[model samples]
Target: MAKELEGKVAVVTGAASGIGLASTGALLAAGARVVLVDRDDAALAAICSERGDAAIPLVIDLLDPKACATLAPRVLEMAGQIDILHANAGSYVGGDLVDADTAAIDRMLNLNVNVVMKNVHDVLPHMIGRQTGDIIVTSSLAAHFPTPWEPVYASSKWAINCFVQTVRRQVFKHGIRVGSVSPGPVISALLADWPEEKLREAKESGSLIEASEVAEVMMFMLTRQRGMTIRDVVMMPTNFDL
Candidate 1:
């Protein structure tokens, strides 16, 4: 049986771990050749080795704006063309805003917000020329609600939500689909900032969800019919409150 994404190419950032890794797996299973981009060279190599030719690894730190701006061209060089882009690279800054380190805030915003924007911007010309593409960003449930504990992280996602919607409108005429997936309290490295007790409490309460679940939602967004755009998907554990 033929898969839905056969012959298409996808570029996934932060592909060595967490949601990016899970999403890469999903895209590969659906028959898309995936370019795995991450700073972790060893992990990327391991994934490529396991997944074979379909997994192309690219090591680049998105924190450097210059490197980020070059991503689409590099992927095009490696893959010939990009049919999909999952801008999933991001960092987390939790806790009260006043207690957050200014430097840490800067880094998180750069990765979560700036990198996403730059990557999509770089890929637009290509997708526009082709008149077809799918761009899905990994946002957070916090983007839709005011989460007091992680104001900085939530704020970054809120910005992404707006960006995705605005960019979707601008590019729909070109046959490019843009959207975001917002998952709450996903089980990933981003949770490292949470207090041990809070993490345990969420887990015990069934308030945490796996990264694979979020990837599932991403696949749904990517696989939608061209006529309809799933602009945003907010997924959370059924037991999660607010």
Candidate 2:
């Protein structure tokens, strides 16, 4: 395998499991040293034990401004120079906007949107100073169209689309690629609480996608060439029949 990403440092938010874990493992396999950040320290430790020193587990409350501020410098401390950032941290609030509690909406916006925006703000200067970086965000299929059941999630993804695209235009000359990957519903630990039996039925009847598929697409988008500066890649399973 080509160590194209060797000697590079990657900071992946929400790296405990799901698509984040898959992406982390893929980057490691491709030879990049990784730092895993998540709220679940126990799980992150288990993952590090499995992957060893190639991975660093950082369990901090990302919602805290001080904590988030400390992230870039910590990443730099660990790897000297940062090359890739996967802004894949997000949460789901599956309720219609009208009746959804105000606090819940705020939580959704804070975790899914505000935190990511701040992560970009905190870490981007390092990339700009170095004159290189790849910023990858995990948005949802809800961004392109709409999902009535998850209005807040859809809104957050739309925000990400705007944020990343605007940054892409602003820093194109610096060679900083800002992009987002939108995936349809997938069977992930993130959705582990959902009725599996129901999901299986939906799968058989066509309703969601696989997590691995989404991760593969993310890797492709992150590693694309100069002429291939794709701003958005939307992937939905043929199973979206539901």
Candidate 3:
């Protein structure tokens, strides 16, 4: 309810739905001028309608490093400074290590790990110059648990978990707080869009974590004191076995 981000600028990927949409709402409510990015053009437009003029729409695949590089300055041109970046866009490919197709493996790795790192590397210089910003990477609980069947997706999450930890320590001196959220799953159009096989795999694993719950936690993390940041927060349903 506190407008901690008043007059600030925040960029969020995966903004069309799921945790990204929910978090976008929270950031807007907190009075942050938000830039919403997602590959889905129609959906992005729809989401922007909900946030109205305060939200800028970016329709680009985050997996493209070239696009990621252009994002910071374009965003700065709008709001003049960047205060928050929630890298929530990602994909899931289900398969065993030996059985996974090389193409699918590459897709998962590229989008999950490489795209995220590209965004961080590209936007960081500006954030560092400003000497104050927050970066939130969306990871998953599978990063910490046994999810051998989803080798590439799980591996990417684990890599991000490690990435956030190290970056938090390295960037604190620059007044940039880097952290990650590990969520179990979120029932969004994402599930409906997934390949039937992959959806079946994910649903068998567990129900999706609600978008609002994840959004609230992300908002809470970003609202901490100027010099403080939460390193990690993992979310799951109460009855989730893990």
Candidate 4:
């Protein structure tokens, strides 16, 4: 039986762990060859090895604007063409904005906001030429509402929410579909510092989801029929509050 994404080529950033890793696995299972991009070379190599030939590992620090510019072309040169660009690379700093470390804030914005824009800018032209592509961003529920404890993180997602909508409009005529999956709390490294008590409460309350669950939603967004576009999917645990 042929898979839905058979013969497709995808580039997934932040692919070494968590949702990114899970999404890559989903894409591969659907028969797409994937270029897995991450900052950790060793981990990326290990996973790519485990996944075999379908996964191509690229170690990159998304914070470098120049790298973003060159990434798509590099992937194209290697993979021939890219059918999907999963801009899933992002960071989070959880704390009151005033009390947050300025350095952490800068890092989060640089990766979560700036890198996403740069990657999109670089990949859009190729998709335009092909006149078909799918760009899925990993956003967060915080984009929809204020997150007092992580103002900067929320603001970054809010920015990308607008970006996805605006870019979807810009390239829709050319057969490019742009959208985001905004998940609430998920079991990932992003929550590693979430005050143990809070994490415990969320988990115990069934308010946290697994990374693989979000990965499946990403697949749904990608596998939609050509005429259909899934703009945004906000996935939160059923018992989640707010």
Candidate 5:
């Protein structure tokens, strides 16, 4: 039998690593052609070389306003149309608010929150015209709780949670499904800056989930029946407490 996503085209931002990379693999396995967007040209080239034509790499610095604004158009130029958008590009900022660099905080918020909104905004017109699409943002469990250690990071996710829900309501009539997958402490580079002790503790406690597991949830969301929308999937390792 043909796969559920056969003939679909998906665009995944931050596709060089972590959840984005894993999601690209899942999309390809489901028979969709995926466009891998990332700032790391070498990584994108390496992935594209292995994946062949099924994985198209678009080197993009999403921090550039011009680049973000023209993202949808660029994808359409490359793939002809977009059936799915995994707006998964982001950065992490942790530690107490006062201890964070002013510039670092700005960059984190821009990537985690602003860029997500712009990508969705840029793609909405096409999806609206087609009246069908799946847009999933990679959110965090931090959004749902006020984690004291990462105030800045958590705040960005909280903003995303609101954006996803509000946009879903507005676009459901147009047959566009907007949702977020909020996972807790996935094993990815986002945790690179975590205090060594905290990271070690979480690992020992089995509180860290693999990126592929989150991708599985994303696949489930994309494959759901048209009439239904898996609005928000909050997944965490069983041992994860918050």
Candidate 6:
């Protein structure tokens, strides 16, 4: 039997590790040709080596907003057309805003917020013209609830949540699906900066989810029947308190 995503082309950012890497695997497993974009050239090459020609690696810094402008065209040149875009690249700063370094905050926002908007903008025209595409963002539970521990991180996610919803409306008529998956405390590098005590506690209590679990949710969003968009998925470990 032909795979559901056979012949589809997907672009996944931050594709070298964690949720991004997991999502890339899921997309490939479902039979989509994948273009892996990341700033880590070595890691990108490593993943491509494992996946072979099915995974095309593009190493570029998403923090450079200019890269977003060139990304779609680059992908088109390499793959001809884009059918799915997983704008999952992001950075996290875990701390009270008062304690956060000004430059660090700017860097986080640049990657988390600005890059997301520009990536979506760059990919939209292709999907709109073809009248079909799926865009899934790796959002966070922090977006839905106020997070005292990381105010800046939470606010960035909230901005993306709103953008996904608004953009979903803007392109629904054109056969595009726009949504976000907000997972709580996933065991990824993003959690590396978490208060060590909190991180340890979550791990001990099984309150932290694996990156692959979130990837499964992303695939679920894309595999739905046409016209039925899985708007948002808020996932967390069963033992998680918040």
lDDT of each: 0.93, 0.82, 0.83, 0.91, 0.94, 0.93
Runs of candidate 4 exceeding 4 Å displacement: none
Instruction: Give the TM-score comparing model 1 with the true structure, all chains together.
Output: 0.98
lDDT of 5 at 71: 85
lDDT of candidate 3 over 129-168, digit per residue (tens): 9888899998988789868667778888889888888888
User: Model 3: runs farther than 4 Å from truth?
Assistant: 189-207
For each candidate, what TM-score against the reference? 0.98, 0.92, 0.90, 0.98, 0.98, 0.98
Give the per-residue lDDT digits (tens) of candidate 6, residues 1-242. Answer: 14779999999999999999999999899999999999999999989999979899997888876766789999999999999999999999988778899999999999999999999999999999999999999999999999999999999999999999999999999999999999998888898888889988888999998999999999889999989999999999889856
User: Measured by TM-score, how close is model 6 to the native structure?
Assistant: 0.98
Q: Per-residue lDDT for 31-150 in model 1, tens only?
A: 999999999999999989999999999999999877777798889999999999999999999988888999999999999999999999999999999999999999999999999899
* RMSD of each predicted structure: 1.0, 2.0, 2.6, 1.1, 1.0, 1.1
Residue clash pairs of candidate 1: none
Candidate 5 lDDT, 83-176, residue by residue in tens: 9999999999999888999999999999998999999999999999999999999999998999889999999999999999999999999999
Report the Cα lDDT for residue 232, model 2.
86
Number of the top-ranking candidate, with lDDT as the measure: 5
Candidate 4 Cα RMSD (Å): 1.1
lDDT of 2: 0.82
lDDT minimum window of 10 residues, candidate 5: 1-10
**How many clashing pairs does model 6 include?**
0
After TM-score superposition, the amount by which residue 128's alpha carbon in candidate 4 deviates from its true location, in angstroms, is 0.2
The reply for model 5, stretches above 4 Å from the true place, is: none
